[model samples]
Target chain A: MIGNPQSVAPEPSFRDFSKLCVHTITTKPWSVEEAAEHFAMSGIGGITVWRDALANRNIYQIGQLLRDHNLSIVSLCRGGFFPNLEAAGRQAAIDDNRRAIDEAAELGAPHVVLVCGAVPGQPLTESRKQIRDGIAALMPHAEASGVRLAIEPLHPMYADNRSAINTLGQANDMAEELNSPFVGVAVDVYHLWWDPDLEKEIARCGKNGHLYAFHICDWKTPTLDLLNDRGLMGEGCINVRQIRSWVEAAGFNGFNEVEIFSNRYWAEDQAEFLEKIKHGYLYHS
Target chain B: MIGNPQSVAPEPSFRDFSKLCVHTITTKPWSVEEAAEHFAMSGIGGITVWRDALANRNIYQIGQLLRDHNLSIVSLCRGGFFPNLEAAGRQAAIDDNRRAIDEAAELGAPHVVLVCGAVPGQPLTESRKQIRDGIAALMPHAEASGVRLAIEPLHPMYADNRSAINTLGQANDMAEELNSPFVGVAVDVYHLWWDPDLEKEIARCGKNGHLYAFHICDWKTPTLDLLNDRGLMGEGCINVRQIRSWVEAAGFNGFNEVEIFSNRYWAEDQAEFLEKIKHGYLYHS
Candidate 1:
């Protein structure tokens, strides 16, 4: 009876997701130690820190917090913003991304997530080609660092100036083009829920060994702002459980990393925010 | 050499776009004749009127407006809202949709566009089934009306409340199941641009003879509002020209309906709104 795949009941919530990774932005103003302490207390398995968050705290300090709190660095907060106007500018972006790869390696992180940049000063397609070239240039360094480069296809709304790689298919194509063991994509539900071919594309990526990471978040109804109106899991319209099922079906066994950019979340106390996330993980997700 | 397909370059300026079709909502408070009059003065090829816009003005009046303004109705505003809890409720949707079809035919519209309803207060997949059933029910009536029912797959955000058929692929699947000449999908750039398999889906629609209408509009970057904040074609970020090229390639020869739901545009004078659409028609397309 359990083998009935067409069961229409609401999916069971994962209450004891001890391996949940709290994104740095989730505890925006919290110090690294504070975040680590909160993560440790929550029984959460890991933390995802952004480059900006680590700017004030040295790597040793950040590393020590992770070690002391027993927090695994699920993935680093990204490196790719490749497109640029001039060849030198483009080269500059490549060099910077190479450093990000190195930083991810130093942090003992599994992947240096890439937000492949959008068209610099021209059209989208041309910028996409440049993004491919940027990744192709940085792939060897990423390989050398033993750090996977996870390309994130930002929403199409960000296609002009944020990230031109706006679809998993497009990202998978680029990853295959680069032909690198280390370069893949970070499949974020917030960015990808609208994709009609997501399941098929995820399967394709799985076939190519390119689906590196998965980020989970709900898309709120009457989305107030495109960038920050993200809903907590199960609060908004997205079928997060359905998406999770698809991911699991596609052979992806990874962290259901929460990455919210909601203004409402940031204003709350860090502990409250962390607690809400933990609660959201409990009954909502 | 000119026999070769003209790749969509930047279109001419809006002032030069003597050819256009004013989608009625651009001027919210105006009558269909008034909107048609506006279209005529601006040298528009057609005007798409909402059901409300047609309510007070009888079909005879609408037909007279069509003749007086030399205006063509590309398609009617809408018809389908299929899924519902009760059988009668579902039947109500179909009956109303059939009424819309009759209205479209009376007003000489080529298609009675269907915005298939979402979960009749249930799961997305169930709503999808309901949508399929509703379409099957309406097919005979739609065929009798001689008005094509174009199923418009809205953006995925509306999957819970508005329409569960949120992808062109899903729409195509339903269209195939119906296997009738009366039902298909409308291709709106705003709803479909984020789609990874857009080109493939467009091609599929073309092959299946289901590409009923093409809607052109930009997706605002910060998209201030969800249902509204649509960009004037060139002013916002969507690569309209590239998409138009794909639509054309797919053999969809029809009115390129400009459907902008921007609060900013709505605030502008109606003539200038039409003129702005003309600009959109011409440049940054």
Candidate 2:
């Protein structure tokens, strides 16, 4: 059953960072070591590591470093770009995803979030099939490594190239079809806040036990860029707290991941930005 | 019944300008008079006049001028902003919409396109209800004037402020619920090309006799600006001809309205830009 009705879903009131997680890319100015140190000092509960942060570093030592700070390794940033015009290209993507899964395992992250890809000008139907198949191919490796896959349905504005999966319903459908315990969904409010069926889809995902992660970010009214212009919670129109209530009602008791890509925020002192994020989380989210 | 399965929908071959209609805003550099003369001289079949172009002009005379060039007046550019937080503001929106319908009547256009509005941070359900009520309020006036209302579903990105109705399915639902011949939905590729259910929804509107208008434009990758960054037909990833095929198969033979809003394109020589549109239409569309 879909837990509490949206109308009666209890409003969440968080006074601490007990469930707060920040993505490495959100504070793009900081290195992973610096982010881990600052986040731990700030009492942030978890960290979702972007793969870019692992470049030329010892993944295992970095994982240990995060553990030393008592930071939970929530997820690896991303791992999917499965669709391509050529078979070899798709295989390359799958290989890259496999490396991502391995990296997640090494980093002690439980899941690898997938930003399911789309080929511009290609039929979405075809890209979607490729995504499903690509995930299917990675199932064995994922299961073996104990790193789950969370399909993050991107906003439709990104449908041309970033992702073919643009709704939680689509992500739920894919997850249900894949039917793997290792496969689930990452509910990001930024991409899905506009959907009328959002509450229903959240319930469906929760009922089916496919809701694996929760990501939060706000959508600015005049979103200046197609990418990297995301607003922090309370700075834009999204009802993040209301959405959190929906997620909680759906039985998702996981990290409330703050994953933002903002040129404006990145230009600021990241330590100061992190403090603002905490303020927004406590008051708005 | 849906007219055609997407797989079997025939490829449209538009080798002439008979079904081509250009929106006044598409060539932003040109004055209404200049756009009318050039579009007519270029053998464009129709024109959709934006309200800005009618600022101080005699509406009836402009209608006559368009007709004198043998150009069919397709529809008035826009007319819906029904959702407002304040009741008086909502009433003002309805009043303004009534004026838009009257303008359409005087301009000799068959319908007024509705960009059914949204208020940032307002629950979409409330905004949607207001939109329905506002449209219903205009029904008597629209019917009496012999001018129809075409509900234009904006892209989901615009749902924050531009429109609460952001899908063909939503527009179709409103039109069916309104159940008036004077009320229908406009299918714009720029707003809806990313929808997986687009073909089915197009057919649904067609079957329900609610398909009132068809607008064409492309979505560029790395779309720098949220608004005013649209592409010409072949310049972006949209399968314009395929969607047109679906529209045609749905029993619609209306003008294919070219509605592009681009700061990049506005800086160009508009007459030359007009040539590109025709070429894009003949080949890409």
Candidate 3:
């Protein structure tokens, strides 16, 4: 297929926010209550709450508050980091994940996204095994709480400490190995837009019923920070609409979750940033 | 083999610099003549000349100078950036690569390591195609000059503007598809340590006679820059010794090329840095 002409379809026009979802971390300045109120007022359809946003709050009441605004609760922000050098640390990670799952269930979210962890000096092969084992340990609690776990394979830049699962193929492989409806993969564009096998892997996951969630963001050319330098949908090099088309073609018809982590955007007036997001969504996503 | 135990063999002790090769850019501060003097004084075996390091000098004489110093001209630093929005731009890149081949031939280097390029905002698939075509177009020239081309897949973080080939597996696929004896893949630990299929792909390339070069460096836990900020061998999390075992097991009996681009190291005294490189090679690599 060298030099063969391959082109994704043109961007689809989004006429409404009926399927739009905003991650609370995308606007880090906002509290969960504030985000819910603003997102609801802005006609956004969904909200994916970061676990930190639920700090010291009544989880059920927060779920009710979001529902009262007619917002569908998407997946919780994060729930994995299972790899550790010590057995006690790994067990602690599992326990924390269980708590995250319980919180997700209480918040009436359907799933919890996992940033499967990696230890700095540990071999990635070993870290991956631990991630799988940790997920297996949490499967019973997850099933009981009716909360799915979406494995979010991070970018390779994060392989040192953030995640051992750095490609969608790896995530799909793990999800299939786990073999549970409650265990699936979350397709995050920031982590996966660079992958050559992304389209094929997306199709595979969709066919196997493991495509559970989709996260949207752009990859800034000069990505300044490994953690917080993500661009808005249309502001960077990622062809977000094209990836979304691939996801939709692969049978994913869920919220187009906007999950950006940008210090620049956070420093801005969040209401204005949210407006830009809405515009970016309507035009770029 | 989802959760299989993969124990790489123990690190082999290096007693000499017989197979040690350092890229000129790794020292950055040293001129080619200065580098030759320092390397020869340190009893280093080989040197990979970055194109910029050869500016304003007679290429053939530079080769002879290095030969007089008893240094093997390992390979030319780089020669690929094939992807461009304009056909004219791609042609310019191909022409530039041809010039690189000529330079390598004149410099008595056996090969040119290609950091195959990607255009920002262009689809990576397109960039990859351009890279393949660019290499194909240069095959006759490369053959005529008796020089090889080594496809060096960069890290995914550089996939935006550096190279679309982000994994050794992808580079292997490209090299196999090109099917030219003059074209092979370079295994760089800095670029590929995160890949799950790395060992298998290395083995495949070795069996197919496509493993041409092996570049060594460590990935820092907090990689500060996308272009620079690489760690010395044992200073970071990369299991350089383990990867070296895999490369050796795959039948690679070539130079353990130390190719680090670090602003931190570059700022240090060049002579002091050379000493550290020697230690890093003998111990960490």
Candidate 4:
């Protein structure tokens, strides 16, 4: 009752690479092609492509390149910055999201992760409304393209300008209100590990059949940068394995996407970092 | 309903400094005597004494000095760091908290704010239990000394080691569970502003008569340092005045305590910083 607040399932054994996925941004030093080659060589199971990694590239060709390496295409990294002061700006964000969905569909990716947006000076309530409206506007495009939208709740630290959806409960509220098979929530450990309502909310989302994607990372104690500075699994305090157990118990049988944005790790030899990720995935996660 | 999720009260006019309180640590460069002289000269209404500011000084004399300046001695800055992995360490924390309470009594402050502690890797649930038990253990002495304890829920960013209590609702639950007249919750906008449930929780704590203190500060956008990069009111996106309105509506007519820990502000001239604080207090807050 004190520590294990609920019946948290024990960690699943990682005997193979079937469930391991890596975000392209996690290996910043490597180009998409390089990441694909290295990831395939490392026996990485999947790859979540960031938009930046696909710049100036042919979406279909890149998709083929990844598939040729036997890397499963997970969700696209992001597509949401919906809150804007001006009407035109909001429209621009929505239009950009449509493009992201189109790209994901072309790339053979099943879903696009949405980092629901916030404006710094705008009231969070207004921002929340805008995020909901933005997502609703995209539902048609998403469904038509056969691409799902996963609402990824950011940490409270990012509530200012990153995302008004700072809790899984808030994300669930929005997703349920929207009510689309094409709309669901992404569970990211880095953003949600500290939430006290995590287990209960995970169960709620799972029961509602809204859990779509699961992202994994750790939170360093003296997190040097708000944007970067995430720890690799087993390098920080987050019980990634425990959270994974909860995610699995919630009926999410998805890739454990290692979506780190650490300047420290990115500065390292990326191949070595990939090796560490494998070790962490096998042992820590 | 989109922007103002509930009926948030409008900002109260800051016609005077009668309700303004400044924490000593806010002016980190100043000695307690220096802070007292400057604060009184500026017509600041109250002072919350941080423990470090009273080091190796006569507590009774400092109390007399503060009173001599016609300043209201607000609650002492802190007391609790209750959670510890070792029994002896936990006892040491309790003993230190007792000393903090005694210091508050000597300084003529009403309550000692509790920054309930956490071990870096300790499960927050376990740390939470330790925090509850620790506070419950200190109830007798707290009652005997006629000193109150305010459980200050820190930001989730500090959930790693600073404090396990990261939400005002959690603090309210603990205060209600403890069922002590000597124990209550401190609502700090810097910590609780991002919470979607804040307005409801504030109202809940107020209805239960568990609201003890209110601290004010801004949360910067690019929060460079987790501990020392807090923004001054109006300099960031927090909408401090609006939050102040909510607290006032919740029946909290306590001092609007300015508790900023900013490396940017601290590096400036302390006197000029005090002027800025006054300006921020009147116009922004």
Candidate 5:
């Protein structure tokens, strides 16, 4: 159980898009309206909206538009970049997070994913402290909005500027320290696949009822760009099926969210890419 | 101490290149012969020769030439790519490793660093098992040659094709499991700097006498190329000096080997680059 979790659970079959969810950023070329139309047309179950996608649009109307298409608002793309050097900056981040929570509440989304930032030269230890303080400050606002906060630990390659919390273990520790029902963890396959302790940590967070969201994508072998160049599920080496089994075993009956950021795929017709995602979902994931 | 090891150790000042070593791959433009002469002229203390740099060279004579230049032959650059899909491929890798051990012994190097390879489609657990078996197979030969095998954990970005061992904890675990004096771990800042468990694992390996080598380099803020694009010391966000303090505090009295693979630096005058390495070694490292 400790070392070989994959062996204990047989591979689960995925027949349709009932549990499939696509992030707005995955098909970056599409407008939110277009994405909602296409996702609903393709029978995709849900959509995670990036903050940018909601720009210049009436958020309430946009939520209505998505619901009109029968799309469940999975979660807001991001809200955390909480670590900052100055008190003003930290306060600004808290304010922004509060707004994100408000937006999520209005959008009928359940949670806001936290990228939990790191400053370039700031010690990760200090950045982590700032992240904790920022999250604590936002808890009251989040509770009032009836929105949960999902702390998404980024890849270690992004540790310099993207996140101080680079492991699920760290995210779990922070969530437990805060001891809030409004705070939890997001499990992203692309970021956490390489970790040896992933299974144990997944179980740990799940058992504590802190597993809020699950995101899926593949790690391309020759990842050309650090921030982009993510592969579709079947294109890379990650055993997504095995990891999905771990998540399902942990009592996460949520969407198998497809969250990819790829310049190559974005340049193509997103409708075609959506078909590929479904194919990958059925056979590879 | 459990979380912030850097705050516990004071930064040590480096006055000279007496403990500085450079890997041959750092100056890829130079031949081993050219690297030896230039490194000696620059008063660099040691050189770790990459296997590619040894092409068609007389190993014994190369060792003699390095000694003549008053350069300590540090551990050979690499010897492991143990994980393979086929038994024949695995056997072939072991044979190559044995040959690498022979070359290291002939080159008067004390150890050979292992990259511990992974196949794109292989599960990391299976690859790790193959790595352990491959290393175990080489232990007797390594001991006979009075040469050690230092398992160098690569960055997790390389988990697809480069190396399955991506954390110092994993490397330390493998080395201890192999349970041979000829088996040990190499600490590289570029690969392990982002790990939260780094300090504890460094102390663990050092206490067990399994910490065999220490490599130094910086991770660029915007790492352009996955294979190359390494930064000079002080060029990126990694706390190279702080990590060095931890390595030293863990009772490692080995050379601070500068190992960079940057396409940008290789395009520069290597003699000038050597001067920068000396400066970075003194002030940044």
Candidate 6:
């Protein structure tokens, strides 16, 4: 027998969607206006909007629409790339992230997911220290805005050029050290599912109330490209239900926000893209 | 002053190699024969042999040469790709690895490095369990040959289709569970240099005396190919000296083998490659 009560339900019903926020990136086919309409149509609990898509509309305009649609922004696109040898460069990154946090707050985002940068012109160890301090510095502004800073630990492959924080445990450590409920971790399945300490760390994050946002995407085995080659849920090799169970077991009741950055999927029609997202949701559920 | 007694020496002489044996892999440019001679010439300590260059020279020949050159074979190129879905395929891999273990014993290798294979058609969590069990089953034969099994946890990038064991902590956990001094881990700087829990894990391994082998290679930014693209010691960003120091500090007096699987270096003249190996010894001393 399957573990989850939801999984035991026979025949996928789109009804009772009182708890499911589908991410906009999953339906990259839809424009910002179209996606907001789609989320309303699907009766999803909420939605996540990307900065690029939001750029088509004014931030204030998008904020107004979400209010009208009764949609909740689980998280804003991102904010932290704070590792550079140059002090000026590092400051600029922090400033940019602060702006992002403000934007997230403006959009009524509960948390601003931070892919806390990489080893910029230095050893990874030193850069990691810089990233830790960077998050600490950003916590005050985030707390004041009522926007929690969710440190999203990217996959270890991105440890060099992307985010040095590669494990949930490491992210939790930073959150615990900050000792602010305002600071926690964004548990992205694509990034953290492979972690052997995942079960232990997720529990720790849950106990600490450090589990901020839950992002979903599958890891394609032949992953041709590092950055953009993400898979649709259940299409690749990830045990999504298993990880979803872990997150849910850890007291997480957030949306399994579908976020795929695939060129193959991106090249498809917007309607087809939305169709695929719906398919992923229905099939996985 | 640094923690070690002679830690202040300029490069080579000041290096605290009390608990480290140096192993040479010619990411620099040397062939297998050339590396064997260099291991003898450098007076550095042990080595781990790759399968490619050794393919031309049979396993028996490899053992004889290691004996002739008076080099300690810290480990054999690797043996675990147990996640293949097909039973015949899985058995084939096991058979090959068994041969690898025998070769390790023939060369007096203290350990056989294992790149625990990846998920075939199942979830990584399941395959990971299979990998651990695979090692456990193979342990009896390994014990008979007097060869320790060193689980080399690959980076998370290789979780699918490569090696499921993607962290030092994971490898240590397997070693601890097996409760055999014969089964342990190989800490390669290229793969594990970015681990945030690395210091604690290294100490843990040291105390367990499970630190079987230490491999060295730099991580290049914009790493073109995941498999073949590795940096030469001092040429790339990783602080090799710092990692070397950490390994030594951890109670391991084993070889710091340089295993660079770079296509660029492989094409270079063997003498030039040998010089760079010597240069790395002195430069990254």
Q: Which stretches of candidate 1 lie over 4 Å from their true place?
A: A1-17, A120-123, A194-196, A203-209, A249-251, B1-19, B85-88, B120-123, B194-196
Candidate 6's C-alpha lDDT? 0.77
> What is the lDDT for A67 in model 1?
70
Error of 6 at B194 (Å): 1.8
| Alpha carbon RMSD to native, model 1 | 4.1
Candidate 3 stretches greater than 4 Å from native: A1-14, B1-14
What residue pairs clash in candidate 6, if any at all? A29-A270, B9-B14, B19-B252, B19-B253, B20-B253, B21-B254, B21-B255
lDDT of 5 at B111: 99
Clashing pairs counted in every model: 5, 0, 0, 0, 0, 7
Q: At residue B264, what lDDT does model 5 achieve?
A: 95
RMSD of each: 4.1, 4.4, 4.4, 4.0, 4.2, 4.1
Error of 4 at B260 (Å): 0.7
Candidate 2: residue B91 lDDT (0-100): 98
What TM-score would chain B of candidate 1 score versus the native chain B?
0.92
The fraction of correct interface contacts reproduced by each prediction comes to 0.26, 0.70, 0.76, 0.54, 0.48, 0.46
Best by DockQ: 2
- Candidate that beats the other on TM-score, 1 or 3, i.e. the better one: 3
List, residue by residue over B178-285, the lDDT tens digit for candidate 2. 999899999999999989999999999999889999999898887888888999888888998899999999999999999999998899999889989987887677
Tens-digit lDDT string for candidate 3 (B1-285): 232113322244435787999999999899999999999988899999999999999999999999999999999988999999999999999999999999999999999999999988888989999999999999999999999999999989899999999998889899989999999999999989999998899999999999889999898878888778898888888988888999899999999999999999999999999988888887687
* Candidate 3 lDDT tens digits, A195-217: 98999999999999899999998
Candidate 1 on B1-285: residue-level lDDT in tens? 233122343434434333356688867756777787777877788777788887766886687778688887788988878878788889888888878888888888878888887652266667888888888887787788788888899976676578877778888988888899888889888887766678899999898899988888887666677687788887665677778888789888777788877788788787877777876777655
Q: Measured against the native two-chain assembly using Cα atoms, what DockQ does each of the candidate structures obtain, in the order listed?
A: 0.30, 0.74, 0.71, 0.67, 0.61, 0.44
lDDT of 4 by residue, A1-285 (tens): 134422232345535787899999999889999999999998889999999999999999999999999999998978999999999999999999999999999999999999988988799999999999999999999999999999999999999999999999999999999999999999998889888999999998998999999998888878898898998887888888889999999998889999999888988999999988987777667
Q: What is the C-alpha local distance difference test score of each model?
A: 0.78, 0.92, 0.91, 0.91, 0.91, 0.77
Cα lDDT tens digits, model 5, B1-285, are 243532333244435676899999999899999999999988788999999998998999999999999999998979889998999999999999999999999999999999999999799999999999999999999999999999999988899999999999999998889899999999999999888899999999999999999999888887888889999888888898888989999999999999999989999999999988887787677
lDDT of 1 at B233: 80
After the best TM-score superposition of candidate 1, give how far the Cα of residue B87 lies from its true spot, in angstroms. Answer: 3.9
Global CA lDDT of candidate 4, please? 0.91
Clashing pairs in 4: none
